[model samples]
Target: MAKIAYILLCHKGPEAIIGQAEMLTAAGDYIAIHFDGRAKPEDFQQIKAALADNPNVTFARKRIKCGWGEWSLVQATLLAVEAAVQAFPRATHFYMLSGDCAAIKSARYAHDFLDAEDVDYIESFDYFDSDWIKTGMKEERLIYRHFFNERKHKWLFDTSFHLQQRFGLKRDIPHDIQVQIGSQWWCLRRRTVEWILDFTRKRRDVMRFFRTTWIPDETFFQTVVRHLVPDSEIRTRTLTFLMFTEYGMPQTFYNDHYDLLLGQDFLFARKISPEAIELKQRLGALYSNDKAEFKISNEGTSLFKFLTGRGRIGRRFASRFWETESTLGRQRELMIVICKKWHVAKRLLEQIRQVTNVPAIEYLFNEEHTDLPDLGGIQTSLGKRTRHRRALMRMLFDYYETDQMIVCMDPSALDLLQDFASDRSTTRMLEVQCVFSDEYLIGHAMRVGLAGEQTSAETLERLLPTIRGDMTFESDKIRDAEFEHHYIINEARDAEENAAPLSNFLDISHDKARQIAQSDHLFAD
Candidate 1:
């Protein structure tokens, strides 16, 4: 049987740590804990009282104060690893985790699983090639020396990082080892742990260089294992399931996510919420009867794409509309069409372009994009060109009304209505709605967002060349005259008779339509 040594490096949540320790020990696993050096005395005492009598658990010597993206975290992890090795000499697999990590599978299953495997599990990707790190400094992380903890002294950290780059101050790596990066969570064979620790001790100069390296905990052991271990021996993946958001924060597991945790092949999951008392208890009781087959449905990649696409909108050009630095921004008369249906919106866009004569921009502010170009060809303002681009934006849409009242059509940025509602310039807004989308109406199933999906099913007649082409149409007549607020209910689709009366439907649907326009919210004050 493979005896697993679970090395837990934790900062906060001592009670959660106690639960994990008890759970691991009950599962016939060895435990080593490194409570953050800066942990509260009372919290530390509670942990000690809970696990002090347990034979399977051992405390790491010289518990270091862990800081985000600093050397202390690596030190804490190493301390726990050493303690585990000394306390549990029979352990074959050494699994790394944090205080919040808990066993989602039975110990017998994990033991049998690893006992059969000859490979070590760790994420080892080339640092230079992989686009893993989301928010912070990437290549710059190694190129410059980070002195201050980024969380505590963000300004100083950023300033020093840039200043070093500005002055061309560069540091040399000890052995010029190709820096491989990965998640800190790893499930390694005892030999790998030994090799990593020995390498850490032997390469004091490497350790010295890593002391000032950003997020050394994520890089140090990963880079070392890749260098020492053969490719065939390493699995290049972790048994532990942990997810970091694009914002670079660990997504916390809660009681509701119990089924989600159970469904995965991961033995353990990191960063369980301290408040998830029921979740912790449920995870502690997870003991499988048979050795489960190791087919994992890791929702890591799928969930990350969703989370990143939704959260990191600033990185995309479509989401950007406002500029902080504005000079001489006089109010301008602008007409904006707020519509979700692209076919209907495109038709309106054509009419506006005809009325204005200089390309009524399609989806200038809409986050989502289809095959059609998203940026509106003129919305982007990268780096130094931002000034002139912003000037052009102001000239085109904001500074003053053009001779023919040039329109700026956007499908997603509904907030723009609220922004310009109270402006001195007479702003006209047409909240267009297609009865075809009555099934996916506002405030319900439909949300026009940065999903990059174009929801349009215009009929063959509507998509005809005559209607779609550059011919002057009836819709163009609407733009010829000035209108403050118009609700163009596009009755394009076939309306079917339902249980509800026509009068009842009209009353309820139009009321919702008015709300969708959100004109009242803008002009309420």
Candidate 2:
């Protein structure tokens, strides 16, 4: 059995710690607890009692009080890691956690999973030039000065450039990863832990460098880890959805909503209110079909309860997300109908006139186009109106061929276009509505007096930079991947470009972008 140690850090984490402990217990790994030094004595007593029975549990004596954006948080973590390594020397892996975090998968499985990949397991860090102010970060000059003063570090400029490279990445990737700073909580191989702790211990300058920033905790460890293991698949982020309500932030504990606990992929998350917790649990269960458990711990709590509860919940939820067939049974129905009016256009335009035919020229124009007809069905016309339609048809037919044009017409016109294109060329012009495209938004805005005609075009020109800005946030390696994902010119490129012209959409304002970045609604799952 591979030994592992789980580290929990918190100011005053609630029952969720119990669930985490249970998770680790079921995984059969040892766990250690580190409470922020500022926690009340009574709270510490309660915590110690909760964890007392677990043989693997060891509560830290050295506690450091941490506040958001303070360096103390990172110090607390590093302290715990030092303790854990000494206490569980045989452990193969280390997963750091917060009191509010819950395990969505078996804690033991994480150690087992280490065998599948050779990643270093640091969360991704990307640049954020535009949202720098939004996230409450200091300007470049201040950040640079602070680090230089704190450690006299020479590499601040290089790190800044590295971050810039990530922000401007342009690629056509379909994955759900965004570059940002690393999270405090993470899972690292024991080898990595040993190396980082050693490096920081010998380099007091590096420690001082980390102490200068608002949340230097994220970057300090990330920077050091990246240096130590440059080529590892540092994920930099997980697929957890976070939400902060309009009122006070949510509470961290609850008992009835066990199903919510199982739906998460991460072992834990920031706190949620009791009301929000209920909703999150219920909604998660309804949509994802996962179950969750809640627990609490202090000094007395054992790691066993955390691991065991998590393992039980994870097994059930894993079967739902991974093993079971989907319960939502409906799928899209595509209807294909073959109609014959193949030769109608050719026959009407006859250079080889047949005597039995009707007045082909007049029939082309006299016919009422209640609905747009299929390309194969429309009679060839020489009148001005028919000529214009033909011009549009030629543009479309080049790509689709006569029989292939899938023009989406309301009920009546579908057959006409289909029939008309059947004979002339194999290419068919597909009919589609432009409602969702920027063109519709622009024109509708103008019609409703919300914008002038040029307003939409001007808005688009302005919005391009912001879109370009947001696209810049990427890790150094991921920036390269982004370039590859977005700019690839293929058959789909022409279709996508022609479909939505930015000239019709508003340039997203800075205010709007900040709102999007900060609003829980924007980030909500």
Candidate 3:
């Protein structure tokens, strides 16, 4: 068995962090935690005392005053990494995590997964090569120096930075070093961690250069690690899931995020708050039960990996439209439109009907008089919209009795749905939509058709061409859109108003109901 070390960077959520530590603890496995220096002494002491009895747990002797998008964040992480390395000399791999993160898999599973790999699990992309430069800080993050966390002479720093930018005076990136950026969380092998420490020691100038850069934590380790390893040795994916808002705020996970969390291939998920006590308890119980039943077997391991599209094999296993009682009137309107655009509607119906091997395909409508054209294998039920939706979902959960249910209405998500169906290693409930484009015609259709929003006939006409194009269900575009949509939905649901609906309808939360309501339709005239 290989020893694993976890370096947890924490400021809050002490109980959750402690739970995480306890879950990952085993003989030869160790944990090192560094509480933010800004945190109260009592808070740190409380977390420390909780793990005092555990011999495998240790705390960093040096804690940096960490702040978001500051050098301190990287400093604190390095401190924890160094402490863990010193404390657990035999550790084969180190997993970097946050205070809010929880392990979704068992320690044995994680160990087996890593033991089968000779590569580092770190998400890295060249700074200039990725969309990060376009979507992220761009020149502001790299060209000018930032003193964002500096309290003293803050005005002076801002003035100086502005003057530098105004005069085209910029800090020169090291000529020999290629800059890379990625998600800050990573799982690195022992040699890689040691190399990073040694690299920093010998390259003090590099360290000093990044000190003034924005969010250096996301880039520093990535640039260093990629530079040291061969391309084949690097796997550009983190084994953790982090949800960020459009404004770049980290999302707090709630009970509703449970299904999505379990569906992902990641070993851990982050930003879980203390308020999610129920979720925390559920996760604890889940990992405990999984760990108990876990046994390393060779049957179908390779095939399972191929089917799921994940690098490591673990255990071999195993939504609502509309709100309103005037659904009949709404259905009449939709039917008239469907009749008008019969070609597109026919294609969509055929595409859905052709989808085979699914346990059952059911459509629930609130209107008793809905005369929707019947498609084979799709069961339709009529009742009050919300009531029908809830009952149907419950029935589907009971009938399938497994996690591999893919519930989607749009034909655009067909490719993604097929992917889910092929992967039997895990159970997932997939809700397909044009999550990439808020202005996508299908999104507008969903808003008006599903959410009961009012729209003009002219808008519907303009949306026809786009809907026809979307019916093809371009796999690449759908995948990208789904990723972006998940990001926004995760963020929005963290807010109070959105939280309620998110809890009630977990899959619908990703559509960002409020944002969709307010968004301008491109086809609207």
Candidate 4:
């Protein structure tokens, strides 16, 4: 088993943070927390008391008065990481998260997924990249000196920044090291983390340069990691899900985003507000049962009666029945159908749900329509149009939790699905099938079927196994597999036949395919 160390930077919402910590608590997992020095000491003590019983939980001895875009935030993270490393020398990986973040998958799933991967999952991009900024570059962040004490020196700093910009006099970026920027949250291997600490310690000049530079927290680690690791070894993607508004602020997740979050292939989600207590509770309950093995019981009273104290046994049994029914009698196999037309997806899902007791049945639909029955686990508005369907597919694969098999299909391909499901031998174990279109041109049909007019050959290749059948007999192997149980079906034949112009345009190597598979294709057309 892999040991993971989670370094949390928390400043508010003590209860929410505690809930996150509890959800992620597992054997060989260590939680090292750093309460911002600016936060109330009493609050810190209270949080400490709440987690005092967990031996794997630790607090940073040196706290920093962390502020947005300041060096203190970086310092606090360093302190927590150092504490965690010192406490758990055998920890295999280090995860940096904020208080607002919550685990979206089971601890077992996260461990298994990380253990199978050898690369570092850090989202880093060149500072000068076009996609790095939307409005324009803020030269002052990298070129001018701005005091961290924004409250006291607000006017002075503003004047200094404008004056430098006006005079066309900008500080030169360090020539020896290339600058990089990305999301602050990251998951790095133990060796990579140790290297970061050592590199920062040895290079005081790098530290000094970033201290006076604006928003050093975002660039410091990204720059150093990119400088040291090969591009092939770095997976320019973070395991946390964050949605930003048009104005460039982190969008707060709400109850409405619950399904969206669950569909994502991310371990953690961020910016959960304290007021969204219902969402918090739902996530807590959902992940609570996400262990290495599934345990079924007739024990425990009904939650409703446990709240009302009126009816107990009868309601408890009813609740249990509902759970079993919704989860396809707890059989473990999951079938997810993706379709652009809601009506098509609805009919297909209804037919499958009625015939099969596959543990889970979820629908990833492109459009939102009314009067759609509550077909158990069906998810709608996955994306606005067909182009966004792959985004939805990526989410479904990322946060999938069951130990059973997963089958995905197009509504048009339901006949094949029914045939596959009816054949017990085919559906009993894992399977992979690549379906080709005999009538329409495969590439044109693919563009019409999926959200993006373009699809990666690698993406198409990855989805093939879900349609055909690939079984992993051992439970351990299923858990450790990168895509152990998912079934992906798209309209393409063998890799050779898919060598047309459009296919050639999208055909990338396996390494590139894995990266594209994990990306958010919401913006793809």
Candidate 5:
């Protein structure tokens, strides 16, 4: 029989904490809990009373008020660790976990597995040499001192951090020790835990150095393990399986993830939502199935590994864009609607959407209308279109498989538009009704025999020459835009005639486009 002491740090969710305490004690293990000082007193009383019958459970001597990116979290964890060791003298190993973590397998399997291992299961990496820190302060986290809490006082934290950098306020770490960083979760042998606790008590210099360091909980224990423990006993991985988003935030799992969680190789998973009632209930029923001898695999992923390796892998996501990208799921759909004036373009978009009865998302690259409509299923970062237009389309197509999306752009962006129509695309060349020819708006004034006497004739007199010269001047530019088939809008022909050579293109009107959207003739291949 192997005894493992569990040190749990909890901030919220009292009922969940009591249930966890009961489960661990039932598994023949000892547990110590450190409740956050900021929690309500009534909540603490409820948790304490619920676990009163368990003799294997203990509480921290003192509670600490914890905040994000502060050293108070490390202090709370240390208190729980000490209480667990004192209460369970026969425990051979120590495991640190957050309140949200739950065992996917039996607790007996966890203790039996750890009891069989000689090496400690903790992730350790050289801080300076490793690319563990991705977004925020890397070397500066250790070089300069941070006083204000980053979450509570963001402005003050940034101001002080910058002022220290501007004046070269630097701190020197002891020359004998090397700084190491890793995940906050670990499962360590009792001998290793005792060594770490003893050193922190004796070395006041190391404690002071880590107190002001950013997120010291990640560094303090990891640094101690490397500086004090033998190299052969350290295994550079954690027992927890976790994942993070591209923005470095943890991905939360819900009841829908029950199958995914059970298929995982690790025994424990952190950051499960407290509101996931079905997940908690189903997983709780399986807690007593703790079989010995390799019931679960030791290989597991950590947050530190996920963050550093994010940008390197090929992404496979947001596949809902496929139906909108092409007429059918198989073809790539795109069209180049070249109308010089935006007023003509807007009316043309309305006609297509009304006739086809299909959702049409327009104004992607037009400068005047970058604020896209609230179109669902379109999950893209709009900022990328401004800085890297070509890269944005490539990334967009990677997530959204599309062959039939109607794309409207100014002639200037046509250079980057070619990539959207690849070898397997079924593209369309669309020409809309000319702005001046339309009878409703600007062209109306001139159409009703008021051009000669109108005071605005001066502006229109100068504009007619450019309108006459515009399409003919842009004939070569239009043909090279990589359009699959050119379709002339069968309204009254105007200067748009010069933009498209009549002999080489197909003729399509409102009726033709509507027909194409309903049936799949143009993309049969």
Candidate 6:
């Protein structure tokens, strides 16, 4: 089986691209580059020449105009996949890589790992509820579909609803899809790629809808993958082998900690300055500068190209999401603890502290109940007032206000939430719930509407489900005790004065947290 590395690019890096080509050379993988037509002529030409030594490099003829939520990137990827297949007819697997990405493993090892897994990597799952197809289109496609043609977006709407009802999806659909998949790029066996291509060609409706949606890159891949192979035995995420530039890298939660760990693991320190000739080398990584020879395992006999279920001939493969839900729920619980106990809310806060500047201690408790203690010499409330509820009720509104709020209910769910927000509102919300992870507390919080904060007539509708989801028939004692505790907290004149019910002051989840987060309003006056 042959392995091909598909790298997608737009205008930014030339040296980074060259460095990646060298890494692909080391991995003995064929390289296909798709420039988005936005790159400077000099940089584009330089990249073309750098890979001139490798007979495997294939550049696409169609240069898409790159942008987020648009189909340009996705189309570019499809073009690259098409070219790689034609140029390297013997290639068995196609790995989608970004120009700034560096392979994490040697070519030989990556190939062997795919061989051993005996599965193809692709995203194939439904993301919304059935009713979502109707009026839901506006909400689901709310983010980025500007590049899509109006006529083409219809299919995305249709496909989304179909996937939900027909594909056995759980209730509630979250805002972001990438977080749901864990990784944006993946390795796909030739068979799977071919299947996707064939399905796209065959399903006129799917193709048509993909043509005009917002964020078609994400919607297209997800919808089609789910429709065609709902039960494929594929590992949802592979290690991100490519290194990304500062701009290209996806935002991270524990970025500082992760960067330190990843740098050590890869033997690199920081991102290379613009003056550097190569990325890994510029970053002080062990890298090669000479012209390199590239070779991939032959299409039919190599270890990397081995297909999963060698003898099976069906497309009904279940996705990895089902098995991952519980694990993700538990993991989010830990992150909540970290945020509350460790005093690190986000990468920015961590970095500022690392750089020797003192951030106000209140930012650490930004996620906690707004009624909590003072920081240093000041007492403040950063929450905003809503028409129906107080600041206490505003933060949970995303989940509580709308019945449509998607519960990721998976490890990546929290990640998805984080990606949707600019800062760490989602993390704080998760931590707030972490206190309620216990059956008694969960039931207690739900029943008392988080200690009478759910009392507003406008908020009562939203609190009902939480009450039902947590409380069961057998636990009257815990229920009664919780009720009494909530009564004491709310009834005491100090309840509003010292209404901070969150056990962990660091894990705050007051209303208006999202509003505060949006305005970067961490420090209260």
Q: lDDT per prediction?
A: 0.62, 0.44, 0.59, 0.58, 0.65, 0.42
lDDT of 2 at 229: 68
The sequence of per-residue lDDT tens digits that candidate 4 reaches over residues 321-386 is 122222121222334443333333344333332332222333333235422222223334443323
Over 4 Å off in model 4, which ranges?
A: 150-152, 163-169, 291-525
Error of 6 at 476 (Å): 75
lDDT of 6 at 493: 23
Relative to the true structure, candidate 4 reaches a TM of 0.54
Residue 331's lDDT within candidate 6 is 14
Is candidate 3 or 6 superior in TM-score? 3
Each prediction's RMSD over C-alphas, in Å, is 20.1, 25.2, 17.7, 23.7, 17.7, 18.8
**Local accuracy of candidate 1 as per-residue lDDT tens digits, 1-525:** 888888888755676678778877887788898887765667888998988899999989886866667898888888889888888889888888876577787777788778887988989899988987654468877868999876445458778988998899998766668898998888888998998888987988888888899989789888988889899999888888777543233555778887777767688887676557898776666653344434467675575566556534656433323342232133334455655455555554443332222225455444333212112344343332233434344444322212113234443343445444444454556655443322333212234241223434453333334332322233444444434444343343222321122113222343333333332222111
Query: How far in Å is the alpha carbon of 118 misplaced in model 3?
Result: 0.9
Candidate whose lDDT is highest: 5
**Could you give candidate 2's per-residue lDDT for residues 287-353 as a string of tens digits?**
2222323243221113324433454477432231112221111111111111112122222223111
Residue runs of model 5 more than 4 Å from their true location after superposition? 291-525
Give lDDT: candidate 5, residue 346: 53
Which pairs clash (backbone N, Cα, C closer than 3 Å) in model 1? none
Deviation from native of the Cα of residue 151 in model 2, angstroms: 24
Q: What RMSD value applies to candidate 3? A: 17.7
Error of 6 at 277 (Å): 9.1
The runs of at least 3 residues in candidate 6 whose Cα sits more than 4 Å from the true structure, single-residue gaps closed, are: 123-125, 129-139, 142-183, 230-232, 241-279, 282-525
